[model samples]
Target: MDVPIKATPKQFYDVFCNKTHYVSNVCPDKVKSVVLQEGNWGTEGSIISWTYAF
Candidate 1:
């Protein structure tokens, strides 16, 4: 599954890694919210919970 985008690799990585909480803003219809349940964002062994509108 290869999707081409204007952003560089670092920018794409930053969105999923550092800006996970903002994902809902990008696609509000599909993603309700993303919460950090344990540890910290972008850290090893960390946990994140995602809520979908469906």
Candidate 2:
């Protein structure tokens, strides 16, 4: 599921590498929070969890 946005690769990569910031900025209404549960972002085996409300 890849969707293209009007951002550079670095910008896009930065957002996904830091999901909390991106999710908060883009989907603050639907997503309450984002947490990194394990491993450093941009590294292997990284895990991220999102708290959201419908």
Candidate 3:
């Protein structure tokens, strides 16, 4: 699926890299929630858990 957005490539990358926890808010229908399971967000070796709405 190719969904176009107004954001620049760097800005879009920042969302996934720096603000992963807020991704669920971007696509609430597809992503139910995002949790930091281990370590810290944006850190190397960190683990995250995602719950999908589907």
List, residue by residue over 1-54, the lDDT tens digit for candidate 3: 799887899988988997899889888999999999999888889999999976
lDDT of each: 0.86, 0.74, 0.89
Model 3 segments more than 4 A misplaced: none
Residues 1-54 of candidate 1 have per-residue lDDT tens digits of 575677889987897988788788777899999999998888878899999986
Which of the predicted structures, 1 or 3, would earn the higher lDDT when compared with the native?
Answer: 3
Q: Sorted by lDDT, highest first, which candidate order results?
A: 3, 1, 2
C-alpha lDDT (0 to 100) for residue 52 of candidate 3: 93
lDDT for residue 34 in candidate 1, whole number 0-100: 95
The numbered model that scores best in TM-score is 3
Model 1 scores worst on lDDT over the 10 consecutive residues at 1-10
Candidate 2 accuracy as TM-score:
0.55
Look at candidate 2 and give me any clashing residue pairs: none
Per-model TM-score versus the true fold: 0.72, 0.55, 0.84
Error of 3 at 15 (Å): 1.2
